[model samples]
Target: MSAAEELEAGGAPTNFDAMVKDMVRLALSSEYARVPIRRADISNKVLGERGSKQFKVVFEQAQRELKRRFGMEMVELPAREKLTITQRRAAQKTEKPSTSSKSWVLSTTLPQAYRIPSILSPAKAPSSKAESTYTALYSFAIAVISLNGGSLAEQKLERYLARMNVDTQTPLGKTDKFLQRVCKEGYLVRTREVDGGEEIIEYTVGPRGKVEVGSGSVAGLVREVYGFGQEIGDSDLEDDGEGGIRPTQVEQSVKKDFEMRLRRTLGMQPLRDRRAADANGVDAGAGAGADENEGRRRSSRRPAAQSESDESD
Candidate 1:
């Protein structure tokens, strides 16, 4: 049936055109930007009920009028796709596949020379050692989150760590310790909810984690280690002339600020060469003082021996 016939059948009021126009104007206003523009939303706000035949007719008429008069079209936002249990598990597996034998060997037997500065490595001070461990764990957690589309299930995180052969037994399990520390230190945020009578935990990079992992330096490290870029959810970033993804100006500024903060937090020294220069300076100063003392004693002995020789003569 025609619009007029449908409106007549639906018993729309004589001033339906004006009312529809007003409803459309209100729906398109900035005040409704945060709330989605849907048939139900418009009906509830304008017609006082969602299931009214008059409202449906008016909604259709408004949409057609808006398009014809103002060249504006009403479009529905895309709904979020819900994944089934099998699909979710498949996605997790694809994101973090099992390590290959060759890769495992290379990672496990990698020499100290090949390790990065902020990565886990041998350190003299206990605090430095702890920092290295934390850094490694933080990097891993961020990588996992990024790989799994900016959030990781807590159980999947544990499975991924186990697959990577992270020692979970020593010192009360590094994986558990890392999770606790990251949450406490604001490097990662954990969200918990009950779904179908079961508690589920999810992890996402927190503010501190973003600062540490999103910087240019850390991005390079992540790319080198995981073969991926540092920007989270930046699958659309364009490649530069150098065969690398170019970061935006805002990203560059953020990275610079993060670098400065990291330097200050880590004692303003290179992660790989921390305190080495200070130790060398102390050793050199001590050696120089000992040499001077020895020289003075020798001169005093020489004078005393010369005086004795002259008396004997």
Candidate 2:
């Protein structure tokens, strides 16, 4: 344990300045994948793939990495057992659905396992360098948005570059390029916002983006990444973690989440270069939005068709 961390843990200054420095460390770490240590019926004697002590060591190491990289204070591992029926019922009763927000019965089914076959398989390191690029960009982008509240615009990119101590005008076209790729991937769809009568592209996450948890299992991945993908930083609102999640962790998690969602929504395709189409035909302007709307309409109309199809079958 570093002396600084020990001091902070031992009730030293718990201010944002001290915390922000730690957050930057996490943002800069190259090997900091936020996978959780699952504590189920594997055995009390073993923690990770090793014995209890070794497992504890590995857990602690991962925790330390999480702290050092993302300013996350060590949290107690999750309880192993499933919730009792009564406990679940009570919890369900207390949970009120968000009535003010719009609702849609979007299909929750996953894509066919064959398309992005690797994500569903047993853990294996990605074979190619390109496979990990989205993850890194996701991490960095999260750090930018979470720690620094800004839209994913060119100005935001410049601000992020400055924070990283890189030249503001550096030719880092990859980030923008990735954004374009995401739009093409169907994980994101862009809208034309009229500003002074000039249409500017604004991007939003899609359903596939909702499932983007990288190689990490879906369990707890949203909490680890976006602090709960639905909301940005509400985990800190509760004191469940003795004091709940720190603001820094919440920020990092949300930002990471947005990136993952962006990747998932966009898919593994190379970003499209459609800036030229900004001046082109209405066909170019219609884009995936029309296709998506048609898809949703078709999907909604399919249950009857499916029943008939089943009857025919």
Candidate 3:
């Protein structure tokens, strides 16, 4: 009789081919496509009772049919290693802990047959050439901002450049130009204000800068060229207003001291470019002052010509 007919007639399924197919389907449908078919469970499921001579015979026949038809023989699952509380603690102490300790525990407890994909792997280094002066400057600026937790004061940046001996010939002018280009090109966001009669400019990573840094491309390039790894832990920075972290007090102090040394040794002064000052509305008339003065002088001379023409007339 067919398996279905035998089931409907209140008898255990005796069709070896049908029984093997059912068991294979059940196994494949289970988690990891492998089911533990215990003898008691099988007896209960197939015969609706445990310990039946006829059920045992049928189960053996099904196993043989499965091996013959599908070349898949049922094998016993390996015994799991059980550890006592003391043993578990000892094992945990021996294992090197990581940030993903919880995940490590879950991975250890997972079935041996099931494999979990690795979380940490060596990142492929970005394919990049030796950057030009502008590219290098851009990369350095972005890297500094990233190292400082994504935002930096303009004074701090200038100090960093001076200390690094960047553009030793004209550090002030070069730094100004670099900042302008990066800000204009959407690689950095420059916010300027006048504080106590001094123009203050602050920089933050722009969209492009964030993308490069977040993808580890900028860090990779920095590592390759500067031999300095730019990676920073998330916990190191304080939360800033712009959804990014700010540099620590120690970092700020170091930069401040370096800036002082640069000032004393190299005479690095904070440049106040007229155009930049005007752009920030700090000194709106800075650029036009000379032009306005020249216009006034010409206007003063123009009245004399007008008087000469009147006298001639």
Per-prediction TM-score: 0.33, 0.26, 0.28
Candidate 2 off by > 4 Å: 1-126, 139-154, 157-173, 198-200, 213-313
What pairs collide in candidate 2?
A: 26-69, 142-255, 181-271, 185-266, 187-265, 187-266, 225-253, 226-253
Q: How many clashes (backbone N, Cα, C below 3 Å) per candidate?
A: 1, 8, 0
Which structure among the candidates has the greatest TM-score?
A: 1
Tens digits of per-residue lDDT for model 1, 180-235: 86776555778776779998888876644543343223333433553333323223
Q: Sort by lDDT, best first: what order?
A: 1, 3, 2
The local lDDT score (0 to 100) that residue 156 gets in candidate 2 is: 52
Top model number, lDDT:
1
Q: Cα RMSD to native, each candidate?
A: 29.4, 25.1, 32.8
lDDT of candidate 3 over 37-118, digit per residue (tens): 5555554555443334455455555545544554333433222222234445765886653322110000011121221123
lDDT of 1 at 93: 75
